[model samples]
Target chain A: MAPAVLIEKLQKRYGKVEAVKDVSFQVEPGEIFGLLGPNGAGKTTTIRCICTLATPDAGKIEVSSINAIANPKAARQKLGYVAQEVALDKVLTGRELLQLQAALYHIPGKFAKERIDKMISSLGLQEYADQKTGTYSGGIRKRLDLAAGLLHKPDVLVLDEPTVGLDIESRVVMWDILRQLRDAGTTVLLTSHYLEEVDALASSVAIIDKGVVIAAGTPSELKDRVGGDRITLRIREFCPLEEAEKAKDMLKSFPFVQEAIINVAQGNSLNLVVTPQSDALITIQQALQAAGLPTFGIAQSRPSLDDVYLAATGRTLMDAELAAAGSRDPKAERKQNMK
Target chain B: MSSTVTPSKPNVSLKPEAMQVSPAPGFFGELVQETLALTRRLFIQLQRRPSTLIAGVIQPLIWLVLFGALFQNAPKGLFGDTVNYGQFLAAGVIVFTAFSGALNAGLPVMFDREFGFLNRLLVAPLASRYSIVFASAIFIITLSAIQTSAIIAASAFLGAGWPDPLGLGLISLILLLLVLGVTALSLGLAFALPGHIELIAVIFVTNLPLLFASTALAPLSFMPRWLQMIATLNPLSYAIEPIRYLYLNSDWALNSVVMQAPWGAVTLGGALLVLLVLDVVAFFIIQPLLRRTFA
Candidate 1:
């Protein structure tokens, strides 16, 4: 079967700014595909092009095998998009907003009514359905928006930063709804900057940075390719930089430890990359003790998505986010996002 | 309670087969449905928070009562053959109210673009994105009708005799044409302006000046040569003078002379033709702007 969504060498530029340089990803039917990146990594721009909200400067987008650029209305029918900003008419009640959304997708009246009720209930928006959305809390607004997005049941649901401002409980709930949608055979493609959000929800992820897909694979596959077990050992809650460096130098002497560095940002904790071995943590602890250092906290685990990002790009995702944040102009970005 | 609860099985009701649920009703039917739905949202907003509508109606009513009172002591037949100043000001107030309200038609669209709500409408599979423009026009026209009715009733209550039933229908038609043209231009501005602040600034400066330039306040004869020329050229003058003629003359016809400009005479039918032309030009000018932002 053709992929539910196929974007090939997608290139979108806003004037001189290349928002999406060369993004290519395919989301298979019945799977959750994630586009993980920093804030300005072109994830939203790529989603916008796929959703027919903006035209790409170059490349192809197909929704359920239909050429999206050539047949936008047909492609729009096949894809449901929940934008990062929950754009609800605050004056309209939650139910009213959903009903309006249902009509927009051209759902049959009887079917729309039934499906709208199901969506409202499924998203736990029943009690708040009749109240104006302006009175709703942030989580309630997001839930109502989600219900509206899914009211017409499209083949693929594209979400841009779906959980950006939701509380922890609401975020977890959103993840479950996405999982359910996949189980029911709806291809889900989401763009998120939160590492854990992508890790927890996406079956496969493409990590993008500065408008390019730098890494792509299952979370474990990408982490395993990085090829090292991570050990985070803090000699003390606020270990001195000299003591952390001394411990790092001592840990580097072990045969199994491949690399060690003192992370100055985290109270000067020592991070060690080691060849996979059950006894590696003990050896590091012994080495630290021999150096007259105390192990305030320590953990040994396989590399995470952050490590995969670090392996692909020398900077961590958080650092890339900070860098992107500093360079972004709010006025220019708002203008870009308006259309 | 949590959306993330892993269900025992998938929602069988939402199976992939269900995803192929249906296409819209026929194309035109779908277009009308979406456009009407969007239009309904605007009406709902007006109903719930009626300050704009209330103010729109009251502002014109005040102009009719107060402005008429201000000119009460002027010499007889100084303005026209009308028995009082209220009759002449009635048409001006009606045309001016519709024009001002229509001029603001773009404010909501500009707000939608800024707030990202327009992105919601753009992403939907509407038959044509022009439905967005259509919804705004429909809403603004309906509002013009309401405001026109109130102004007509107030004029008659204030002793400005009612026009014939046929005259009222003509007034309605005239307001529709004027609203259609002005709404198009305003919606275009909504797309062309960078933000709401700039859009509002434009509306603020253009609103009262356009009213004053047209025949809404005084007859063209009361103005200097240049002012009469400007009033004759104003589209609002076409709408105002025709309705004014209908009020002053019960024996009205399409060929009845409505406005006598310094250059020549404009018949009722000719004034309407001008409004129609204005409508066509407004649509033509905004086509590229709407396509740029909406397409």
Candidate 2:
């Protein structure tokens, strides 16, 4: 069978902003595929193109071998999209909202009733199903949005930042539900900026930056490709720049330490990439003591998805997020999403 | 865990044909279902709030009682022969109320667009996106019908005599045509304008000017040449003249002259034709705007 969704050479521009430039990815059936990126990195734009909400300047989008660009109506039938923002009419009850969704998808009346009941129950929204959605908490609202997206049982379920604003408990619950969705033969695709969220839930991921796919692989595979044990050391809670530089210089002399740098954004903490399985944390602590510098905090672990992002993009995701946030135009972005 | 076990149909496949084993409804059936579903939501909103409806009904009555009294002491033969100002103003109130209500049709749609709720409707597998337009038109026209009835009842109670059954029918037909065209333009504005603030601005600038330019508060003869020319050119005038003619004469015919315009006398049949042409022109003007988004 063809990939559940295939987007090749996707390119979209809003006036001068090239939101998605040469993005390509294929999501296999029944897998939780994550598109990892920072804000303004074109993840939502890519999702919009896939869900047929926005037309691309250039690309081939296919759902189950059906060309989404050429035959959008047919492709839309196979795709279910849960946008980043949970949009529900405040006046409409949760059940009424789902009923509207079901009718829009053209599900038969009797079948729609059965499916709506099942969705409400599965999402644990039974108690609140008949209440106005305006009374729902943020978590409950997101759950209702998820239920609406899944009401039709589309072949591929696409979500954009599914857990952006949820608390820790709600985020974990959403993760579990998404996993269950994948196991039940639904092809799940989600975009997220959270490293652990993608690491814990997504089976495979594509890391995008500034509209380009910088890296794509399983989380572990990308981490393995980054290939090192990471050691983060801080001599003080707010380490001085000189102290961090001293630690970085002392750590880089060790044969096992492959690279070292001071992260200026995080209190001038020293980050060291050491050879795998090396007892780098203890050795670094000892060396710091011998050098008369305090070891306020230190950690050693295998490379994570963040390491993959940093290795490919030369900056942490948080730093990229801050940079993107500073330059974003909220008014322009709202205009882009309006249609 | 038991709930998680749901939705696991083993027949999941990537091929399109496999998913189509159960036949879906035809296009028109699906369109009707979706349109009704949307229309139902609007009615539910109206039911719960009822504020807009209450205000819509009350405002027209205020216009009838207060504005009618404003000119109550006018000399006879001011508006027309055998017609009092109260009787003459009922048609204007009916037409103006419906026209303003239809003009505000874009507000809800504009809110929907701004709040991203429209994106939900757009992403669905709709048989045709024009159903969105159809649903809005249906709701606005329905509200117009209710408000029109309220105005008619209030006018008859206030000594503005009721039209005959056929005249009532023609009044409704005129209101329906006017609402359809105005609703189309309002919905088109909802899609074309960037935000609700801009849509409201357009509506504010439009509402009163059109009312004044038409024969809503005065006859064509009461205006100067420039104003009379504009009144004759206004579509609201076309709708108002025929309904006003119906209220004045119990035995009204289509070909009877309803108003003497600056240029010439316009018959009731000619007025209906003008409204129809206005409807056609309004739809044509908004076709490109709707196509950009809906297509």
Candidate 3:
């Protein structure tokens, strides 16, 4: 069977800015695939192209073997898109908005009514159904938006930054709902910059940056490819640079230690990458004790998705996000997204 | 409470053979549905928060009563031969109300665009995006009709004479044509302009000037040569004159003369034709612009 969604070599540009370039990924049936990137990394553009909201300058995007660009209407029938922003008409009640959504998707009248009720109940929106959306809280509004997207039960559901700006409880609720959706045989594709969000929910992920797909694999697979356990060691609570360097040099002599760098930003602590071994932390402690260095703190863990991003891009996601934020022109970006 | 029974296997309803769900072909029917749905949304909004509609109706009624009184003391024949100044001013108020209402048709759509609500409609499987344009047109025209009726009723209550039966029908027809044309132009700008602020700025600058320049406030014959030329060329003048003539002459026919343009005399039939042509031209001009943003 063909994948639920197939995008190959997608390219999109907003004037001189290449929003998406040379991006390709496939989402398997009954799986949650994530596009992980910083804010300006073109994940939204890629999803927009797949949903046929914006025309791509070049690329092949398909939904259930139907070409999205050539037969957008058919592809649209097979795909449900929940945009980043919840664009509900404030004047419309939650139930009324769902009814409108049902009509737009051409659901059969009887089935539409049943499905709408089911969605409203399942999403815990029954009490708010008759109230205008303007009166809804952010979480309630997002739940309604999700209900509207799922009214047609398309084969694949695409979400952009699904949990952004939500309170912790709402985010947890959204995650549980997404898991239920995946278990019920719906394919899910989502874009998110939150590391923990993708790490926890996505079965597989593609890390995109500067409009290009830099890495793609299962979460564990990508993490394993980076191949190291991280250890942060501080000789003193706030060590001098020279003492941190001495500790780093001594730690580098260990056979399991692959690399060591002093993190001056954290008061001259040493961050070390060690080959995964049971006694690596013990070995580092021994070395520090021999040097008459008092161990202020020490911790060790397997590499995380952030490490995967850091290894691939040579910069942390946070750094890249700040850089991208400073360079973005809000006015131009708003214009590009308007249509 | 009803968790008593567990079956041998999870109950899975036999799926009906997947019904072929597809959008209708061609843009017309889909456009109709979307337009109707959008227009229905506007009416629902009006039904719930009717402050704008209330203001629209009340403002004109006040203008008809108060402004008419301000001119009540003027010479009787100074405005026209047999028509009172109040009667002459009634047609201008009616035309002005419709024009102003139609001019504002873009405001809601522009707000939708600015607030990101438009993206919701665009992402749907719309057969043609032109449904957005059609919806705005329908909503604006319906609103113009409501405002026009209120103004007409208020003017009549203020002792301004009512038009004959045929004249009333003609008045509605003219209002429809004029509203259609102006609504098209306004909706076009809603798509072309960057934001609601820019669109509202344009509307503000153009609104009162167009009203003053047209025959809505004063007849072309009463204006200076330059002002008369400008008023004659204004499309609002074309709408106002025919309705004004119907109010002033009970026996008026299609061939009855409404105004003398700089170059020629415009009859009632000629003015109606001009409005029809203007509607066609306005839609034609906006076709490419709408296609660019919508398609």
Candidate 4:
């Protein structure tokens, strides 16, 4: 069977700004694929192209073998999209909104009724079905929007930031629902800025930045490829820079240690990259103790997705997020979204 | 937060074969389904929040009673050979109400675009996106009818007398043509303008100027040469004059002169033809805009 969604060299530009530049990825059937990036990283733009909301300047998009760019209507039939912002008509009750969604997909009346009820119950929206969406909380509104997107039963369900504003409980519930969707053989493609969201749910992920894909793989494979277990140790909670540097220099000479750096932002904590071994942390502790450096705290864990991003971009995801937030022009972005 | 509320096999029933469970309903059937669905959404909104409709009806009735009374004491033949100023002003108010209401048809669409709800419709595999255009036209025309009926009833009560049944039917046709043409232009603006703020700005500057330029409040003969020329050229004047002719004349026909413009006499048939031309031209002007957005 063909890949559920294939986008090649996808390029989309709004005015002088290239929102998506050379993005390419493939999502196989029955797996949760994630496009992980910070804001303004072209994640939403790529999803728009797949959903037929915007035309890409240069690209080929295929949805289950249909050329999405050339034949969007057929592709649209096979794909379901839940937008980043839940665009519900607040005046409409949840049930009425679902009926409108059902009609748009040209679902048969009887089948649509059955499908809508199933979606409502599955999303746990039975009690809120008859109330106006304006009266719903953010969590309930999102669930209703999800039901609307799934009512047509598309082959691929594409969501952009599915849990951006939800509370922790709602976010976890959303994750559970998505896992169930994939288990039922629906190809799921989502974009999210939350590291944990993708790490916990996506079987495969592509990390994008500045409109380009820099890394793509399963989460564990990416962690393994980065080649180290991380050890964070602080000689003192607010260790002097010279003492932290001394600790880092001593830790670097160990046979199992791959790299060591002093993290000044974390009060001069020493971060070490080491080859996987049970005694690596003990060796570092022993070296610190022999050098008369006091140990305030110490912890060891496997490399995380953030480490992969840091390795590829040399900047942490949090740093990239803050930078993106400062530079984005609200007026220009709203104009692009309107069209 | 409990997992029990979450179904383990939520989409299990959503086998791909469910789509094949129903045969294709054919193109026209799909078109009607989507159009009616869209149109139904608008009606549901109107039903739940009736303020706009209530204001629409009341505003026109106020114009009929208050504006007519303001000019009540004018000499009987000063405006025309009509029995009263109310009679002469009745046609203007009817046409103006429809024109203003139709001019605002794009506001909802513009709001939808701004709020991102339009993306929901665009993402759907619609049979034809023109169904969006169709739904707006149908809703606006129906609204114009309701407003027109309310004004006509108020005018009759204020002693302006009713048009014949055939005259009522013709009045509906005239409003339909005017509403459709204005609605097309408004929707074009909704798509072309950047946001609802700009669209509303355009509507604000357009509404009163067009009313003044047309023969809505005054007759062509009463205006000076330049103003008369502008009023005769105004499409709203064509809509107003024919309905005024139907109201004041008991034995009217297609050939009966409705207005004596500065150029020449414009008969009832000629006026209707102008509205038809305006409709065709409006559609042509917005065709490219629609294609750009829809594509």
Native contacts, share recovered per candidate:
0.63, 0.50, 0.31, 0.55
Residue-level lDDT tens digits of model 4 in A49-122: 99999999998999999999989999999989999999899999999999999999999888888878888878
Query: Which residue pairs clash within candidate 3?
Result: none
Tens digits of lDDT, candidate 3, B63-132 = 7777777877887677765366778778888988898888888889888887778877776777677777
Model 2 misplacement above 4 A: B1-22
lDDT sort, best first: 4, 2, 1, 3
Task: Name the runs in model 4 displaced over 4 angstroms.
Answer: A238-242, B1-20
**By TM-score: ranked, best first:** 1, 4, 2, 3
Score residue A8 of candidate 3 by CA lDDT. 94
Residue runs of model 3 more than 4 Å from their true location after superposition = A234-242, A264-268, B1-32
| Cα RMSD, model 1 | 2.3
- Alpha carbon deviation, residue A72, candidate 2 (Å): 0.5
TM-score (C-alpha) between model 3 and the true structure = 0.94
Count of backbone collisions in candidate 1? 1
| Candidates, DockQ | 0.54, 0.43, 0.33, 0.54
TM-score of candidate 1 on Cα atoms, chains taken together: 0.97
Whole-model Cα lDDT per candidate?
Answer: 0.88, 0.89, 0.84, 0.89
Per-residue CA lDDT of model 1 for B76-145, tens digit only, reads 8888767778888999999988988999999999989999999988888888888889999999999889
Q: What's the TM-score of each model vs. the native? A: 0.97, 0.96, 0.94, 0.96
